[model samples]
Target: MAKRRKAKQRESRAPRFWGQHAVLAALENPARTIRKLWATHDAIAGIDVPPDLQVEMAGVADLGRLVPQDAPHQGLVIEVEPLADIAIEDLLAGAGDGRPLVILDQVTDPHNAGAIMRSALAFDALGLVTQDRHAPPESGALAKAASGALEILPWCRVVNLARALDQIAEAGFWRIGLAGEADMDLADALGGKRIALILGAEGAGLRPNVASHCDALARLPISDRIESLNVSNAAAIALYAAQNSQESR
Candidate 1:
């Protein structure tokens, strides 16, 4: 039917994920829709895919042609639709006491976002919030960097990050902006039952508007030997610090 043709057209243009983690995660996520899957014989042997789903057997070279150059597909590639969007309200509604939130401002790089997602999942953070216009779309590079975190993490894209921060505050989250210029330390800012950790894009740092929305601004305790840590690394450290702070109390 016409609907099936349109669906096929959408799948043709949709993103293709490769690698064992990314492909397998996509397959495992019920929210994900896999259109076309191709895998090498050796790779397929270890995978227990749905019996009803048609899978194409391919060689390593054939799978290589499906993804970006030198992407390390690990003998798998699959066409898929982007996961459905999550509303910020729903994200906040799901937050529990002591669970942290990671909010990104203008962090456009997919690698950093992916790594942050990985950290958020590792720390059991409530969710990730980002400006809809400033964040990268789901892609193979991101999924690869996240190591499967992208499929499971609750991600919220909003029109205005500052406005979203206000909603976050109204929901009883004490917002802490990670600003190198702030005199406050991250540990001191973790006073509330729930914490909302905000980070910004590298180089530019937090915008004035977003910074204004924060309840307090805190910086990581890093030596001057390095100007600053990578956003993802900083997020991991901060999340770890938050966890320790919560557990010690």
Candidate 2:
């Protein structure tokens, strides 16, 4: 009796997470079992929720009670576990048709990372590659920023980024790093059977060795007035350019 009572208590105390990515992912994935859903009035519109699933309609403050203080839940939260990671070998082997990949070099900001994931999905990117230590963990802010893209795209974290770039190069990818001060524009430098768009930290840019690993460096054709564009925005533009270039070729 005590054991059963303790289990019930633990179940009740479990918190729900919010953000479109987190909620929508839970809904889409059959393996992700949802305990309860707390949604804002505006967010819950035009959805047929399962009758058995627990539903709570509440405002931001009520939603805040479920997650950490800093979580940007955006008025929707669903309790769930983390997704599994895919092996590098599998991802590379599947890169058979020579689709483009976006390699993230130490861009750890969750909002930025999440936004990149969203863009990657939008352009049908192969996958997002990030260094394990430097990448952001899956969280509410990331999920919120992803806006449901976190579920579809595979975010792979590797130990050695340089070696990973080498593997990518050996696999027939023309690695192009996005730099503000590069001599060539992005469209001019995109030449290959497969392309890996390498992006680095916002202010710091790509590391020297990482840049050297790439076959070429390219700059976005943007205003000379501004020094740089936001990292995620730059990624979206680069992905779009790469996909377009691939299609043209």
Candidate 3:
């Protein structure tokens, strides 16, 4: 009996996911394969969850047993496998009406990336492009910051960002590099056929090669009083500018 109990214990020790939005989105998505679910009686009562999915009604400690002690599961936890990453070529091919795409050049911070993703989705941008090596691994913090958008947005990790920009240009995207020192303002750089808003790390801004790859260098029209806007905020402003310009025409 002890051996059987130990076997059951091993089965229960799986990676559990939390966050109401994350779990609910996962549950609603038919493509998402959920392994197990643990929720308090009150929390489960709130949702019209499917009957076929495995469920357990338990206390907070029961959820503690499923996930890390530090996790803020908010009365529920779900164990699921990671979804597959999307391809850049497929994303470009699938572009319906030439919406803008945002490219990250070694912007490694997960919080910044996730925040940028949230903004991207809000502006109805095409998708995101990042280097696989420099970017952060997908985790709870990023997912939380994205507010359920991390799952929906297509983050295309490519081998080289500059090379990817070259591909994007060939695919008919006009690359616009955002740099503080740039002579051209963002609005002046607008009216392009298709824009790839290329950005880089905050202090360093866009690298020389990365800047060289872009068709034009543009700056946000802000006073020189501040050093610079946060990279994610810059991205938001740029995306907004792009959309606003497109709508005006």
Candidate 4:
């Protein structure tokens, strides 16, 4: 009885996804379990609702109150259970196609993480990895920034990033840590190996232990005038470089 009550409470507190793209994506994802949906008539129009799902129609003004004051909810909101966590081992085992992977170390910003996921999807990367303790959970801001990529991208959160790096290395992936101070250009470092691009937070790049775990440290070729690129921008460029490099060989 106690366990059941606790489970019910937890379910009640699940994240509410808003915005047209976020809510629509969640609705389309068969794996996503939607608890409730609220939308203005205009917002719900053209969006196919599941037959068994519960929905409520409300005014745009009322819909605005459901999310952050500044959030662009687009009159649609959904209460959904978070996606189940994926195993790093499962990701590696299914790496026969040689798709690259992205690993984020202590990237706590939801917007940055979401943008990275968008880039990962754009480049057809296998998945993304982050330290469970340091990463952000599913949120409306993240989903909005991702623009629907969040629903498609497989995200894995692990206990120890260094240990996860070790497993990635053992899986025949050439782990390349990105740092502004690195000598080798990202393109030069890529010798057509199945790559796992490791990135860190904005100001402080990869930590010592994380950098040590990587097979090589590489940098993007940019002007020395700027300190460093935003993590998401760096990720997009790296994915493009990796894809182009592999195709050229």
Taking the tens digit of each residue's C-alpha lDDT, what string does model 4 give over 225-249?
A: 9878999999999999998977887
lDDT of 2: 0.80
Highest TM-score scorer:
4
- What RMSD value applies to candidate 1? 4.5
lDDT of 3 by residue, 194-232 (tens): 888999997988889889999999999998898789999
Worst 10 residues of 2 by lDDT: 1-10
Global lDDT of each model?
A: 0.86, 0.80, 0.79, 0.87
Pairs with steric clashes in candidate 2: 17-77, 17-78, 18-76, 18-77
Best-matching candidate per lDDT: 4
| Global local distance difference test of model 3 | 0.79
Positional deviation of residue 217's Cα in model 1 after best superposition, in angstroms: 0.8
lDDT, model 3, position 102: 96
Query: After aligning candidate 3 to the native by TM-score, how far in Å is the CA of 59 from where it should be?
Result: 3.3
- lDDT, candidate 1, equals 0.86
TM-score for candidate 2 = 0.83
Candidate 2, number of clashes? 4
Shift in Å, residue 207, candidate 2: 1.5
| Candidate 3 pairs with clashing backbones | none
